[model samples]
Target: MTTIPSIIEELDQLRPVSDVAGKVLSLLDDSGCGMSDLADIIRHEPALTANLLKLANSAYFGLPGKIGDAKQAIVYLGMTQVVDLILLVSCADTFKGSHSGYGLDRGALWESAICAAILANALSEKKGFKSTGLTFTGALLRDIGKVVIDQHVKSAMPQIMERVETQHISFMAAERQVLGVDHAQVGAMVAKRWHFPPLLQCIIRYYHTPLQADGCFTEASIVHLADAICRKMKISPGVDDSSYEEDERIAHSLGLNETVINGVIGEFSEKMEHVRTLFLAG
Candidate 1:
């Protein structure tokens, strides 16, 4: 088996997308970036522009007419949706691959990420949390570490599986025992390298266990819960036992009743095609 490089070394070798997301957010916040400005930013990338336009006109958006340009798309979709779309486009390639170590096949990771992101966004909306755009992006890419860590996990599969089978341990724990680091840590390191917002870095790192965070933002907790929910619902891409204890505190923090959570799952299931359409549309 090839030796997995030290976390710091591995991080140093990869490019971060957070800086790009930050710049995009800054431009959006500064307000000098109107539809024209948005169009200008996307124009240089024809593929992104075309895809954005496609999504803007998709059944998900329910627009009155086809969006002919990026400017029009942004105006109709609203800046928040536009930004979310851009972030989605930006992270597409990174999340598309299979992580066989985790049993994700081609497109499996992407589907899981999309489902988690949608649920995260839905939960955020339900809780009235602002920065829904950032929450959605963070949730979508939250598992990014899995991409990099899969190779190491593949190498250490035998030992890791042994632990999981015998110890009733989480896969992440097994991963740490065999590889010295887990996907969440590796993912957070990568997000930091990308210059992603500090909040996102935290979510990437701790979404699995958000109550442990000192500040314990409700948004992070929502994503954490949403990840577990997605896995439990079998929306996850790969084969996971999906057996993790719930953080009851998150439910309380968000004032989430079982009814509301159930409703969201029903809505999510109904709208999944819309979600898939946004990403998979030509």
Candidate 2:
């Protein structure tokens, strides 16, 4: 039998989405790249450019006029949004499959991930966090490790589920017991391999337990809340597949009341189709 550790070690060498995504990150590193510069980069990839233009004119943005070009998109959507949209579009390929191990069918895991990213972005705005760029991208990519780990897990599903049922353990804990490493660690490893931003790596690693994190750039609370919200909406298949509980600290820290949380949830539910169009069209 191939041990999980060995499989992971071998898989670690695979760049997956890193090669292309790394270049995208590099181009946006300074964040000073203007519309023309960004347009030049988008034009380098014909398909990406086409998708960008299509999404810009989609109902999600609701511009009065059609956005026929990358430059027009930047003008209508702003540079930060344009850059974030590029990253979102480019990263979608990394997660366009099913993970039977986690019981996520085609696009199930991806849908949940997108919801998490959307909620994370909404929460960041509510909390007045500048630059939801990193937060949105980080939340979206948080489960990249699962893409790699799910196959091995699918093969060991029975044992993992039995342990979860018998011991009442978290899915991640069950995963660690059965596979010798959970998705969080595997995700961090994947993030490092992909040369993702350090803060993003941390966000991926500690998303399940934000309060335990200690360092700069803590969006742990945001990710935690977003994950809960997505699960409640059945966007992804959580291990237990139950409704998510509120992290009281997270809400308190953000000064969120029940009304506000409910309101955001309502908004998300209403706009989900629009958001879905943005991602799918890209």
Candidate 3:
């Protein structure tokens, strides 16, 4: 009996991202917003400020000396990267726990999400997409519906898996067949409730099937490809790992081929160690 209303009701009890994080996301569309505005807001959240400074000083960025404050971090990392880190730090706790519904243990989902976000950012840059940050955020939060639907999915795992085995459809399709809604759709609902931008909402909703997004096909496709690449790498995979499908047409449209895909994978593998240690460390 996990109806949409029930799931929507569960959102009220779910831990919310910080107000400061929400404000940063809201400012993304503002032409007047600047680095100082973001730095000021982040400075108020000591935990977020600490995490940002730690990440800035990590070997991943390779700055000359220590970054002492949020403003300096912003100056070094740039606004998009700073905002990406804010959202990542703000949402990390929500994704830290085990989600058995998707066969993800403690920290597994977070690792997978971080991998997807990085790959999506890389792909966006390769494709020369203007919304690299949007793609990064979209890939990171694409599976957020699982947070709300985990228990339901766990209870119905048997039936969902049966459909997956017999029908040879994606896990998302089986989710819809058994539960009347899939994670992507539910994720879109979460984004809407959180007042995320329309483009982001669309990317989360249609990432698995990017062609369905009217105006956001490219952004959604990038996330979709990134998720597929993550699963292919077996990086913290879930029960739905091999059950997901990729659209060759979408890849072709994005000018992605086996060579480009392999290059991204190699690049991701090289950076994986540093990123995991830096982002997941206490």
Candidate 4:
């Protein structure tokens, strides 16, 4: 079996996160990372600052007036939003292309990622999770392995789909059986290479199999359910949407019944549409 370090080394050579985004992700677990701290770090990057301002000022924020500077934008946007933007800016270059590995067309992965992220954020709120920042970030980048392992997956898709069709297994499982590594595992290595927080790493690594996560089970489960919901809604980008089996037990484990789950999905769809509009408009 290929070691994790080897995968990380290969992925690092493929161009990792920007320095600015690395700094932002490092603060994912910090409790006292204030607005000024984030502002100080983000303001140095002109392109990041501009993009962050535009997003904050977009219909997403519904602010009364324009955000004048990075600090002001941080104030209005909150630390989590700023961090999410920074993460997006960091990975946008790599994730911008068509990730044919997962059968996603141009921009499809980003669309599904954002929608799952929005839904994860909503699920966190319903579960009364105070620090939903990492949850959202983890959800947003859940499929990053797809970008890293696109070609490998593309090459094996024929055999992979055959396995999926022949046996009652998930695309992820098929990927593991055929390719020896699934996107979740690759994504976890990618997250580790970037020094993502432990929970975030766990979520990225186990979003597809929340039951297998050793820790951060709730957040991982949230991402899993959110991803499944987005897949059902056709927002997810992949040829194996059927692989995301709907497990009511996942919701039950989170203390959420069917009604609550549906409500969260409904609200997530409405809010995600707005986020989609703003992001695509940019």
Candidate 5:
């Protein structure tokens, strides 16, 4: 078996976000970027421009008449939401594919990821967590490590699963024991290679083990619950299945009791169903 350091060092296949999305991310991280500035940057990507225009006119936005202008679309959607879509579209090639090793078919990871992102955004807001956009992005890109380590994971599944059953450990823990690294840790390395913010790196690194996250424990916890909810609900089973246990204490810490959990499930479903069409059209 390869050491974790070697596995990380060998991760040269990590996909870089598109230049336009990279620029947009830089500006979003900046404190001074305005709507006009964001519009100016997105206009250079013709496909992104067209998609934004389409989404701006989608029924979900409910604007009067048509919005043919780039600035208008940016204004209507807000920078955070626009950035969210950009990240999705830019990384589509990377995340929208099937990873047989991880048990996700084509676009399964994409569906689960966006679903988790939407819920994480909502959860962060409800919990009064700072930087909801960061939370959303972290959730969206949390499992990217799976892409790098999927084949290794798949080959080791027999041992991984055996540990899960015999040691009373989560599937991810078994992954660590078998591979010396889990998807979450590999995901953090992926994020670092992609120039993701430190907080996002931390969230991805410890999403499956939020208690290990020192810098962004709450954010990691939010991502954890979101992933668990998706897996439990089978929103997009991927390869991980639904073997991991949900941390009720973590949910309680975020004020997600049974009622809130039920509400989150319902809201997550409704939101995905309602806005997915817009995303597809875009």
Candidate 6:
């Protein structure tokens, strides 16, 4: 049986997010951190620097000229967007492998992560949310616990799905009932291990049940909606996809309705294609 303690021990054996990425996440909570501070940290990692420039100069940004350096990329893309790109590059490798446990073949989870991030950003913009970066980051990593618990879920799928089909419960609930934990809880643990901000940790932990996040309810709600939207688009869905339960009241609280959500879905489809080419096609 895969117990929570064993799962936590396994996290120690798993590859940690890169030091550069850790610094960037830490800087997000630092109000004193400046553009130069971010640029300096990114410059130390050649691959991250290269990826950031490439993403900044991509047609997605529609820049008139090239972004020659990290600082310049920040100037054009803003601190929030630049941080998002760096985190994406830093964390991309972990999602590259096949996760058969979750029925995600090579790169499937990565595509899903990117799709969620983009959708979250777009949704935040529509709602005039000031913390688009936080929402984007939260949505991007919302399913990371799946990566941690994938093998366990795979081995126990029989029991988990039995409950899902017979009990008519959400997959996450089934996961908790059988495995003693769910992906969202495990994902929040991963975020804490990665030294992410407390708000972000709460967002991940309570995204499936945003009202539980207390002060961070709105942010969690945004990520929940984004994840729900991703599933609705049927973008690289895994076995646990269909059982997701969206909170309609939370949607109403965010001032979102079916019409508004459908509009966002249309926008997501267009952007997903463009981003697929720019970020994944390489």
The candidate scoring highest on lDDT is 3
Estimate the TM-score for candidate 3: 0.96
TM-score for all models, in order of appearance: 0.88, 0.89, 0.96, 0.92, 0.90, 0.96
Q: Which of 4 and 6 is the better model by TM-score?
A: 6
Tens-place lDDT digits, model 4, residues 203-247:
999887888888878899999888988877888457878776877
Better by TM-score, candidate 4 or 3? 3
Quote the RMSD, in angstroms, for model 4: 2.3
Number of clashes recorded per candidate: 2, 1, 0, 0, 1, 0
> Across residues 121-173, which tens digit of lDDT does each residue of candidate 6 receive?
88898898865348888888888898899999999999999999999999999
Q: Report the candidate with higher TM-score, 3 versus 5.
A: 3
Stretches of model 4 off by over 4 angstroms after superposition: 1-9
Instruction: State the lDDT of candidate 2 residue by residue for 2-66, as single tens digits.
Output: 37667667566654663445666665555665568777777778778887887788888789887
* Superposition error at 37 for model 4 (Å): 0.9
lDDT of each: 0.75, 0.75, 0.89, 0.80, 0.79, 0.86
TM-score of 2: 0.89
> How many collisions between residues are there in candidate 4?
0
After superposition of all CA atoms, the RMSD between model 5 and the true structure is 2.2
Q: At residue 265, give the lDDT of candidate 6.
A: 92
Model 4 has an lDDT value of 0.80
1-282 per-residue lDDT for model 1 (tens digits) = 434466557666555554445566566446465666666777777877877887788788799987998888878877777888888877777777778888887777888887888888888888777553367877888888888777677778889888888988887887778888888888988877776667677878888877765543665788887887787788754544453667677888779888888888989989777777667443
Cα distance off (Å), candidate 2, residue 142: 1.0
At residue 282, give the lDDT of candidate 2. 32
Please list the residue runs of candidate 3 whose C-alpha ends up more than 4 Å from where it truly belongs after superposition. Answer: 130-133
Residue-wise lDDT of candidate 3 within 168-261, one digit each (tens)? 8989999998888999998998898899988899999999999889878999999999999998999889999898777799989999888988
